[model samples]
Target: MADFVEKASEKITKLSDEQLERLLNTVREENKIYDSIIQSIPSGLVIVDNNWCITKINKSAKRYLHFFHLHLIKSDPVWNLIADEEVSNFISFCAQKQNTNTNEEFSIVSADDKARFIVVSILPLVCDGKIAGTIIFIEDITAKRQQEILMHRMESLKSLTNLAASVAHEIKNPLGAISIHIQLLQKSIKKCREGDGQLPDEKFMEKYLSVVNEEIENLNKIVMDFLFAVRPLKVNMTLSEPDSIIEKSINFFMPEFENCGIEVSVNLQGNRNRLLIDEKLFREIFINIVQNAKAAILSSKKSNGKLAINSFIKNDHYILTIADNGCGMDEATCSRIFEPYYTTKADGTGLGLTTVYKIVKEFRGEITVNSELDEGTVFTVQIPVPQKETMLLEE
Candidate 1:
């Protein structure tokens, strides 16, 4: 807090010498009042001199920036606290800008997984028509960003629900015919080889058949996964071992992880594995998250990859968190991750995470994601446990 005070209001008439001296003494005693008001303001306030030195900073500014005022003062450049060059350039422009107040919204990720969106309005103070200093007002908008993400998810769920039946009717219904046709073609090829009794370029025929078979199988799997994603929730919720479910899901992707040189660790400590959850639905959720982690690692082009899974009981909920050392995402990608048909992968259908979100919601669970680009990603899930007495009473 600074001892600076704004100019006295001009409500007084022409006063005698004694009256003027009394008013001056009163103002001197109220200097701390201005400091208190500045410190109590919710928005961050920073005042910089013409030389770009941080002359006055309020408490909110220090808290928002996650820095101490002491570290930034003492003739240190103001822009050094902000890592981005673009932000620094804007600050410089704001300080020198004359006769105008500039407003801008930018995001800053601190030393944590969360990103802070801040709106800055820089007002230049002019002294005798010359640029003197700047007053930067900062407001945090992180909650606004989170609200936008929630709205996007609601819209995505509506779209997915409306399209699910039509897609299944148009494509999935013909899958049986497609599979039968592929089998017929295979039999026809076999007969041709048998009739000739002298197969030429047999390796060529085999390779072509292999590629076609693999693609058809891949297509069939994609359709099934999509249908599963759009399927109505009819899970059989019962007492189940959570660790077993985790292990089973990991087993499904074990070969792929090993092939990619990815090491995975699972910690089920304090996780009693006693929960009322649908085993199949749990498997589906784990598969989607684990596979995406693998895809992220592959995209990073790093020498090695790591996947860590930790589960524990917190309060009345079972919490699970998965961390990966892989190609992380920016704020935009992270926000839209749970939306249907929004994917970072070139070959991804983007319904995978959407399905996971749907299942989690059905189970009355909460899920969150944190990522840093080029660093990694982490997903935390907390599923509430129902009381045994309440269930028995219903019966």
Candidate 2:
């Protein structure tokens, strides 16, 4: 709190008695009006002393403190009430800031609970150019912040949806045409080789047919990837075994392992393997990732690529990590790896990773990539487990 006497003395000496009395009366009336306004304000307001103790609190501030089991006191620690590092540091710094000059806003949690945002301002009172205590204003803008986040999320979803639709529309026709050409080439080969009395263009025809088949397969993969992104499905949410998903996908990729000279190892943290996931889509997710691991290992030319697949239950989510000691991607390559039609290989479809990304998003899960050039890449997927109600229904 500032010294009212010093503040009064500096200006009072220059005024007559009648003038001073009128000024004092006007000040008192203004204080009453300000108190009324503070009480009616939606957000909390607390004026703290130099030591960060509550000096004066409005009605809203009192209610907020009571809800969070805090009391107004002198010389008490403001940081102690808000046990978040960001908030504590912000207030400690703001307390030293000149209120009239600096205006700072930061997000603060509610008493070591969840992420509750608050915008705090420090306003200083000065007497004759001397430092005085600060006045703190606390406004709860949690709902507004959440609304902004929701809007951003909606926009991202819309953009992704539109991209998927465009890719599907553009790639479907080409894929169909490629399939027709493959069928026609196969028929022609069967007809031309039927009367093989030293076929004239047999060698050239074989080479051309092989190239056509390879390209057709690649185009089909591209089409599937596009369809996976554009197509929406109703998820079957259940407590699924994470390790089983990994094992199944690995077993399915055994042929790839033989071809690529790769070995896979699994480590399950505990018995908890269940997650709320769609069995079919989850299988697709694992296939895409494991296949990627095989490709990376093959491309690197390592004697045997070591792929470590692991899953663990953490918090309210199930986390799965697929790590491969293959030729890892650089930062630039990793950034666009999930984008549709973005491939590094000359003959690659560039849709495998895109499909993996879409499946992860469908489950409301997050997938993060960490990779370095030549070292390897580790992809972490976090998927939320079904709640008890949903789990029971599935059972």
Candidate 3:
């Protein structure tokens, strides 16, 4: 290739003035076309030398630079144009590792003091098997990022609306029952006053009162559950043993488990290291899940129902799993198990799993369920190990 270039150079020098002029004109036209292509690109393009000096920039890049209150000057350090220290540092790090391809997204405040999101991609410019510089592609993704955020908020608003509707529906049923019972009681008393001037029969009065009382209790429970599901939890982070909490929660329900003929098996061999969590909320997590499992077992009507709990550590996270050999849920049910006011049981408030989900998320953890109809279900919870403990374990 070197010899060929040398021959070509000699031929170029040997050309007559007229022919050379024609050749130069053609070369200049081709250069103009290349420049036009670069300028026409929508995304910002910048070329920087090995010294981090801006060598060439398209019109789009210049416009972006202007936003940053920078000018397109020859041999200007590219870092000087970046207002974000983190972004500048990242670019420098990437440039140091030649031949590296990097794509990064970050937010910057332009000269107008308006926040903008920018995506940057850097590619190595190679010459003679060595990196001579880098080609940077910058894209202003402020509009796109804002659109995504707006869409997410809209989705959240839609979910909130659905939740409100469910709450109203739940309250309406019990409220309607209470109202009917009250009206009946009023009529009975009015008839007694107008006819015999005597009180209503004890049994009839008791029946109506009991119905009203039960309906009121149901309404209270629904309100409480709704509040618990929506209220921001007050988390008190503590380093506590998960096994102990699990044992306590299970023991609290031992009588019910025995009466329902559901066998409970537990294996707590996970991280011996205490987890950083809220003790009350963490216990609630176990209680809710165990209650859910017990209900599933009862629903299955299994003669030899079994509830199994296990714990282990993997990938710097503590994993707690509960499996029940009970009537399982279908895919649709499983998918919405964590949604507010979603339940399969007649008496279920539908907020048990929702509360569990919120608690797990408070700990920066994750929960997942897998089940098949007529089979069984498994709920897996993963809580990240505390940073200090993880570091100690690694050591």
Candidate 4:
């Protein structure tokens, strides 16, 4: 009885009623504010004690669990919620590591059963120089991953282009020499056969030589195309008028349109926006898009397919729209059209639009397209206005 009374007296002496009440109220308010902020954030946050026991979860984390068909409960194992074994292993490894928490990437299946990419960061919450708990922050990165893939594709195309240029340069000299020898041999054979009235199987020999010559020509054309695709030409910087550039591109492709029985229309209505563009590259971009449109229109089953090139200045930006009333592309194709070596046209190198995309990006411009199957296709290119001034040549 004496020992129990003594313990009670010590407890009462250590704590003041007002101090205990104030501390409790202050802690409750702080917890409420922390919870409010965590729930407000879009990123999923999970708080766990040192034992890896989930103590607090935000609404976003609950939503993520519902999406992934996982039930979140008190003391739920974080590893059980994670779908990827590698991620689970990583989490365990991080938990074991006393210092230097790491960020890990994981793919989780949502309730819709779609794989969603997320970057998870584990941060240790230290109290009195000892880890008290950990905070796990999950950031949805699906769009970022898609962009990364696109950038990777671009890198691959760049490397391929460089390799193609190297190979073309190496083959050109040998190919030229072989072509010269072939021409000389053909000439010598013709001369000898002409001298000998009875040509020794000249017909068969001529046919054989013709076939060889045709094959060589085809190889040469491929080489030329590769070289053209890979060669990086110096840009001739000039203050170019958008209207003249359009006019020149149209003029350049007029003959092709006539030959293909396709009608070409140009609507240049925008204020003459002066831009610093490499004339040659700009022409190539315009020509490629126009040529593609012409071909598409020509091949369309419709008797009269139309191609239109419209350029206008809008809000300090030069907006150019190229539309073709031809068999248009589906959504899948439009998404991949800018991709290198992706094309629907037969005998297409698949580099035309890619080249256009590259040039537009270099100029800090943007290009986008809209197309519906059998309806038509429209591509919009917005070129920003340059602050620098230069002399503009009139056509």
Clash count, one per candidate: 0, 3, 0, 3
| Evaluation by lDDT, superior candidate among 1 and 2 | 1
lDDT of each: 0.72, 0.69, 0.77, 0.70
After aligning candidate 2 to the native by TM-score, how far in Å is the CA of 190 from where it should be? 48
Task: Report how far off residue 266 is in candidate 4 (Å).
Answer: 1.7
Encode model 2's per-residue lDDT on 305-383: one tens digit a residue. 8989888888978888989998999999999999877898888888778878877876778999999998899999998
* Pairs of residues at least 3 apart in sequence or in different chains that clash in candidate 2: 240-274, 240-275, 242-273
Q: Quote the lDDT for 242 in model 2.
A: 68
Best TM-score among the predictions, by candidate number = 3
Please provide, for model 1 over 279-384, each residue's C-alpha lDDT reduced to its tens digit, 9 standing for 90 to 100. Answer: 8998888878988888898899888899999998878888889999899999999999997677888889878888888878766688999999999999988887
Model 3 stretches with alpha carbons more than 4 Å out? 1-21, 62-72, 96-99, 109-118, 128-130, 139-169, 192-395
Q: Which of 2 and 4 is ahead in TM-score? A: 2
Model 2 misplaced regions, further than 4 Å = 1-156, 160-230, 255-259, 389-395
Per-residue error for 221 in candidate 2, Å, reads: 14
Off by over 4 Å in 1: 1-231, 390-395
User: lDDT (0-100) at residue 303 of candidate 2?
Assistant: 92
The C-alpha RMSD in Å for every predicted model, in order, reads 21.3, 15.2, 13.1, 20.5
lDDT of 3: 0.77
Q: Which ten residues in a row have the lowest lDDT in candidate 3?
A: 386-395
Task: Tell me which residue pairs clash in candidate 1.
Answer: none
